[model samples]
Structures are given as C-alpha cells and as structure tokens.
Target: MLAFIKRLLIGRPLKSAELGEQKINKTKALAILSSDALSSVAYGPEQILIVLITVGMAAFWYSIPIAIGVLFLLTALILSYRQIIYAYPHGGGAYVVSKTNLGVNPGLVAGGSLLVDYILTVAVSVSAGTDAITSAFPTLHDFNVEIAIMFVVFLTLLNLRGVTESASILAYPVYLFVLALFILIAVGIYNILTGEVPQTLHTPIGTPVAGISLFILLRAFASGSSALTGVEAISNAIPNFKQPAPVNAARTLMMMGGLLAILFSGIVTLAYFYGIVPKAEVTVVSQIAEETFGRNFMYFFIQGTTALILILAANTGYSAFPLLAVNLAKDKFIPRMFLVRGDRLGYSNGIIILGLASILLIVAFHAETEHLIPLYAVGVFVPFTLSQTGMMLKWLREKPDGWVPKFVINTTGALISFIVTMMFFLTKFSQVWSILIFLPIIVLIFHRIKKHYDAVGDQLRLTTCERSPDIKGNVMILPVAGITHVVENSLKYAKSLNPDQIIAVYVAFEREDERKFEEKWEKWQPDIRLVTLHSHYRSILGPLTKFVDTVAHKAKEGDYQVTVVIPQFIPKKGWHNILHNQSSLLIRAYLLYKRDIVITTVPYHLKK
Candidate 1:
C-alpha cells in the first residue's frame, strides 16, 4: 500500500539510465531556474520602500537611485557568472570555484553561505506568496503559516517526482506571472503618460520619525539587494541543462537578469510617481497593481499570478540546494546520506531537509515577509563575494585568452559584492549577526566531518591481501524450548556453518517436561546431542546465560569462537505477537554483553 501511494504521487521509478533523458532544454530551464530571481520583483521593490518609509515621504524618491545601484550590481553578477559557466562547466558554483582558487576554508565558507541562502529563499518566498493570498481574500490571513507550509510540502513532493516533471509543473505559472507583470508595466506607463491619476494619489504620505541619513539609504540598498538572492542558482545548477549546458545556463542567466532589471525598475518608478505608501495590510506591489488595473479581473489576475510565482519561486532553491548538498557530500564536508539518489533519481534526502528547514522558518517567523526580509541578503552576498574573488584569482593563475578583461570584471564584482556584504553586516547587525556567526560554525562542522571521514578511511585502508585467519575450534550451541519445527529449522541452519560440534540445550523447569523431551528426542533420532539442565528457580535466562559464559570461557582458552543460534517465531498478525512469550528476546539481550559469544537468529514463519 505504501509503495502504491509513493508510485501514485511520484510516478513509477525511473532507471539510472533515464537521468540523461530528464535534462531540460533552455525554455523550460529558464522558468524552472529563474523563478526565484524573477519572482523577487513581487517584494524586492517593496523591501526598498519599507526601509525608506522609515524616514519621511520625501526620502521615498531615493528608491530610484537605490534600485539603479542594485541593477548595476545585478549586471556585474550576470557577467561574472557567465564567465563561471564557461570556466567551470561541471557546475560547482561558488563552492567549487572558491575551493579551486581561494583555498579549502574559503570554499567551505561559500558552501555554508549558499546553503543558508537557499533555505531562506524558500522561507521568504513562501511567506511573501502567502502574503499575496491574504491580501486578496483577507479572510485567510489567520492561516498564513499553514498555507505557506502547504506550498512547501507541495513543491517538495513535486520535486521528488523528478526534475523535468517539476519544471513542467511550474513553468506555466511562471510564464503567467511574467505576462501579468509586463501588462501591469505597460498599462502603468500608459496611465502615467495620459495624466490619469490613481485613487491612491490622494492617500496621505507617511511622516518620518527622523530625517533620512546615509545609514538609512545604505540600509534600504541592502534590503533591496534581496532581489539578487537567487541569481546564482542557474550557475549552480548548470548540469541540469541540456547538452551545451554552460551556454544554455549563461543564456538563461542573462534572460533572468534582464527580466528582473525591467520589472524591478518599472515597479519602483511607478510606485515613486504614483505616490504609493507602505501600508500595514497591503504590499507595495499589490498597491501598484490596483492603481494600474484597479480592483477588477486584471487586478485579481495579477495578484493570483504574483502569489503563485512567489510560492513556486521556491522551486529554484529546490532545484539547486539538493545538487549543492550532493556536491558538498562528495567532498566529505557533510554526511554521505545526502549523496544517495532516490528511486526517481532526485536527491530525496536533500529535498526533504530543505523543506523541513523552510517550514521551521515560516512557523518561527509567523509567515511574515517583513520579519524574514532583514535576514535575507547576508547569506547571498557572502557567496557572491567569494565566487567573484575566486574567479579573479582563476584568471590570474590561468592567464587564458582575454584573461585581463575577465580579471578586471571579476575584480570589480568582488569589490562591489564585498562592500555590500560588509554593508549588510554593519547596517543590519542586530538582526543578521546570527548568519555571520553561523558561517564559521558551519565551516568548523565541515572540518569536523572531514576529520571523521579521514579517520575512518585510515582505519579501513587495505595494504596487502592475505589468507583468512583460521580458528582453532568453532562451537555452535542451539537453545531449544521443545521439540518443534522451529528447533528443526535452527539445527539445519547451524549445520550449514560447519561447526566442529553442535549441542542442543534445553532448560527444564520440571522433571516431567525433561523426561518427555528426552523420550521424544530418542524416538526421533535427530543425530544432534541434547543436553538437559534442571533449574530450581525456573529462571530461563539465568541458567542459560551461565552455560553460555562457561562455554565461551572454555573456548577462549583454546582460541575458539562460540556461536549461539536461537529460533524466532513469526506471527501473521501484529497483535498475535503478544500472545507468545518472548524468551528469545531476553536471551539475546543477556548475551549481547558477552564479547566472544556470537548470537544468530533463524526465523520460522507460521501460516496461521
């Protein structure tokens, strides 16, 4: 029944040879991989306004410059990653690049940062998606965390089916979101050109508690930098693309960057011109959609698509995180369980881990996007800095054709990303210091895992082949309750081991039971010797344990090993197990502490 349910949900298991057939082409790849970056436009500009509105309405104009700065950084990242695609076609992303050029410790740092960032991507995206839903219905606001978790679970199950299947399932919603945004942008620009004023134009602007400062602007920029969080996913998962994976991945990266730049810039520009204020209930993007298309069919369409894309945006992390974990596991930086593939050829362990972590974050934060936004950008920029720095070093070491240009581009990106990373630390220290502290601790954990693997490798290393050591004597002892089919099965298995001697011992609580067993054994002529020991206290384990200890001690004197074989009964029904006494369990438990006595169990299944 469980296997049928699994097959029903995830489809039939594919062969290992089918993995290549699952590789996606560029069109589906863009939707699958770029959804996170593209979906950020739903809340990225809103994050900027959220930070700036803390100052006065006068400072809202700063969003344009801040967004342009973010756009500049986005461009640099796209170009830098294109170079990465060409250079490292095997798809390690920041971890591999940093390890190769910047050294092992830096590489582990990059891996840790990316790992945290991917988890947050899921949390933040799902929370924002739930927010979109609540904005439309308003009644479902109470169940935000539950809704977000459902989306996570849904995505997890879809991904477990297979990569290509997940991409196909998610591509339509992403395309819908893109179309909706473009329509919103076009209609919004037309309304502005025709001097059609929105009802929100008359809405009162928020007053600043204090004047705007450089610190406030920097904080806003850092917040808006959340837009760039998922940009590296395409580079990280280049292997999932079809043939010529690097070229397809790079093209997808450029397309994602372009879409993000246009959507983000348009939304921020419209919000600035339309004078949309940050509201407690509604998001800045929702407000812009209402002002552009009003509370009608188009408005709900935009809202619906926005919510869907945000929720499905987590697909980006689902696609990349498992692959990243598999790579880290290959390097012995994490547990080997992550390296195992599922029946459908997905990294099932990694997918489940990512889902559980995201659910925790959503529940802890109460599914509030604002609360999670502050913790978002730190993990992203750390890997960006390390990856670009590594790329710069690679160019210097390799000195390939056009190395100088690549070196300069990478250097600029490294500097910009480093500054942004430190800015995130300095500006949002109280809220984000946990990530900064977590990175080194995770790196230390990686080192510890590597140390453990190293030690195990040393212990298991084989130098030379030799013949197996011979035992001087081997004794097999079978403990029987009575003359039954279970005892016959045990004796047969014991004979297969070819022990030097076999003794079937029976503990008799009464003289009558012993005499009956002796008479039956003599009549059966079973060829094995039967020894009966009478117990005064009627304690089955006590006398049996002492006999095994004596046998073990006698065998140890002659460099011999003792094997104790016990027979276990299998009942058809689970409840039937309670009907029988579990003497075998007690005997095995008592014998477990003895060093030289080996215990084995042979099962006899009962049809009834």
Candidate 2:
C-alpha cells in the first residue's frame, strides 16, 4: 500500500536509461529555472522603498537611481555568467569555476556561499509569498509560518517526482505572473500618460522617521540587489537543458535577464510616478495594482498570480540546490549520500535537506520577509564575485579565441561585484554577522569530511602483502537452547558449509536443565559432540561471548576462520516476537564487532 501511494504521487520510478527523456526544452526550462529572478520584481523594488521610507516621503525619489544601479549590476552579472556558460559547458557555476581556476579553499568558500544562498532563496521567497496571501485575506496572518513550510514540502515532493514533471507543474504560474505584471505595467503607464488620477490616489503617506543621507542610499541599493539572487541558477544547471545544453541555457539566461530588467525597472518607475507608499496592510505592488486597476477582477488576478509565482519561486532553489550538492559531494566536501541518485534520478537527499533547512529558517524568523531580507543578498554576492574572478583567470590562462574581450568583460564584472559584495556586507553587518561566523565553520566541516574520506580510501587500498590464501581450515560453532527443529535445521546448514569441525555449545544456568538436555541428545543419537558450559551469574551471553573470544584468539594464531551459526524462529504475527527471548539476535549483535568471525542465522518457520 505504501509503495502504491508513492507510485501514485511521484509516478513510477524511471529506469536509469530514461534520464535523457527528462531533459527539458527552452520554454519549460525558462519557467522552471528563471522563476526566482522573475519573481523577484514583485518584491525587489519594495525592498528599496522599505529602506527609503525611513527618511521621508520625499526620499522615495531615490528608488529610481538605486534601481538603475541594481539594473547595471544585473546586466554585468548576466553577461559574465553567459561567458561562464560557454567556458564550462558542463554546468560549472561558481564552485566548479573557482575550484578549477582558483585554489581549493576558495572553491569551498564559493560552494558554502551558494549553499547558504540557495536555502535563503527558498525561505525568503516563500515568506514573501505568504505575506502576499495574508495581505489579501488578512485572517490567515496567524498561520504564515505553517503555510510557508507546507509550500516547501509541496515543492520538495513535486521535485522528487522528476525534473521535467516539476517544470511542467510550475510553468503555468510563471507565465501567469509574467502576463499579470505586463498588464499592470502597461495600464499604469497608460494612466500616467493620459494625466488621469487613480481611484486610490489620495492614499496616506508614511510618517518620516529620519533624514536621508549617503549611507541610507547605499544601504537601499544593497537591499534591492535581491533581484540578482537566482540569475546564476541557469549556468549551474545547464545539464538539465535539452540538446546543445549550454546554448539553450544561455538563451534562457538572456530571456530571464531581459524580463527582469523590464519588470523591475517598470515597477519601480510606476511606483514612483504614482507615489505609492509601503503599507502594513498592503504591499507596494498590490498598491500599484489597486491604483491602476482598482478593486476589480484584474486587480485580484494580479495579486493571485504574484502570490503564486513568489511561492513557486522556491522551485528555483529546489532545482539548483540538489545539483550543487551533488557537485560538492563529488569533490568529497560533503557526505557521499548526496551523490547517489533517487529512483527518479534526482538528488533526493539534497532536495530533502534543502527543504528542511528552508523550513527551519521560516519557523525561526516567523516567516517575516524583512527579517530574512538582510540575510539574503550577502550569500548571493559572494558567489557572484568569485565566479567572475574565476572566469577572468580562465581567460588569462587559456587565451582562447576572443579571450581578450572576454577577459576585459569579466575583469570589469569582478571589480563591480567585489565592490558590491563589500558594500552589501558593510551596510547589513549587524544582521549578517551570523553568516561571517557560519562560513568558516562550514569550511572547517568540509576539510574534516575530506580527511575522513581520505583516511578510509587509504585503509581500503589493496596491497600485495595482504593477498595470500589462508593456510588453515574453517570451524563452525552452533549455539542451541535444545534439540528442536530449528536447531536441526541449523546443524544441517552448518554441515553444508563443509567445515573442518562443528561444535554444539549449550550455556546451562541450571544443572538439572543441562542434564535433561544431555539425556535427550543421547536418546536422539545425534552424531555431533555437545559441550556444556555453566554460567554462575545466570547470564547467557557473558559465558558464550568469552568462549567465542577464546576460539577467535586461537584461530587468529593459526590463520583459521570461526563461523558461528545460530538457529532462529520466524513467527506468523509480529506481536508473537515478544514471546521469544531473541537470544540469536543478541549473539549476532555481539559477535559482529569482532573481525574474522563469521556469523550466520538459519530461521525455522513457526506454524502459529
């Protein structure tokens, strides 16, 4: 029944040969991979206004200049990643690029940064999406964290089904969000050009707290950089695309960048022109929609799509995090379990871990977007700087065709990204100090894991001295309570192994019991000799363990192997197991830790 349910939800597990069928075309790839950057426009501009509103209503004008700077950075990053797509066509991303061009430690730092950033992407996107829903209903505000966690679980299960299935499931919402935003932008622009006042024009402005300054403006620009978070996901997951993987991935990245530029710039410009303020009850985008389309069907449509795409934007993380984890695991930086593929050929372990981590962040922060926003951009920009720097090094070393132009572009990108990374860190230092502490610890963990794998590899290595055949014969020991069908079956199986000798040992806690067993053994006329041992402490395993140890010591001295065969019973009902003492299980558990001791069990089926 459990298997049936799993098949029903996740579909039948595909054979390994079916992996090629899972590759997605450019259209589905765009929706699946680009949702993170595309969805950011919904809240990216508002993050800027959130900081700008601290000074006064008049300071809102600075959002335009801040957004322009963010847009310029976005373009540079897209171009740099496009070059990365071609240079490392096997989906190198930041970690692979840095590892190959830079040193190992720098590569690990890049991997750690991308890992943390992907987790935060899921957390922040889901939280912001939940905020959108709560703004509309207002009554569901209490269950925000619960709802966000549910969304994460849903995405996890969908992804476990397969990559193409998840892309198909998520594509519609992304398209809907794009359509809704375009409509909102067009109508808002039309209203402004015609000199017509909105129905909700007389909205109250927020009370100013302090005056604007250079520090505040820089901080606002840093905060708005959240729009650039998912831009590198395309290059990271280039293998998931159809034939000509890098070209398809590059085209998708270009399309995503163009959409982001238009939607982000248009939304920020319209919000400024309409004088929309960030409100506690409604969002900046929601307010813009309300002012342009009023409380009609179209207004609700825009809100609904915005909420959906933002929540589904977590899909972007679900796609990239697992692939990144596989890369890290391949390099021995993390556990090997993440390197194994699931029945559907996805990195099931990584997907589940990413979901759990995102859910933890949501619960810890109470699903508040403002609380998570400061923790967002820092992890992302670290990889941005590293990837560009790595690409610059690649060009200088290889000197391929057009390397000079590529080198110049990447050099400029590296400088800009490094400056922005520093600016982001300095502006949000109070909220982001935990990341500074967390990164070094993660790097240390990576080194420790590498050491462990290296040690295991060294121990398992084959050597000429250890390859000679054994000179002595084998001995089998059978432990029995009494001569029953179970014991008889075990003895027959032991004879099949053709050991040099077979010893039947019985631990007797009481003398009368030992006498009765000996009498029965003689009456049954079994050819095997029986050895009876007395336990003064009434402990069965203690005496048996000492005997086995003595046997193993003698065998080691003569290059022999001692096999312990025990008899067990299989009951029809699970509850019947409690009626049995489970002595065989206890014996096997104790003997397994000793080397060169073979343990085997023969089970006799019970009628009852």
Give the Cα lDDT of each candidate: 0.88, 0.88
In order of appearance, the predictions have TM-scores of 0.89, 0.91
Question: Number of clashes in every candidate structure?
Answer: 0, 0
Candidate 1's C-alpha runs over 4 A off are: 198-210, 464-469, 477-484, 503-557, 573-599
Q: For candidate 1, give the lDDT.
A: 0.88
For candidate 1, write residues 1-608 as lDDT tens digits. 78899999889989999999889988899898999999999888988988887876777878888999999989999999999988888888999999999999999999998898889999999999999999998999999999999999999999999999999889999999999999998998898888896544532334343587888888888888888889989988988999989989999899998999999999988888788888877988899999887899999999999999999999999999998998899999999999998988999999999999999999998998887876777788888999999999888888998899889889988998888788878877887888867888999999999999988887666753433345797898889998789988988899888898898889999999999998898887468888888999999887888888898898888888899999998898878989988899889988888888889989999999
Tell me which residue pairs clash in candidate 2. Answer: none
Assess candidate 2 and give its TM-score to the true structure. 0.91
Candidate 2, residues 248-267, lDDT tens digits: the string is 99999999999999999999
Question: Which candidate number has the best TM-score?
Answer: 2
Best by lDDT: 1
- Report the Cα lDDT for candidate 2: 0.88
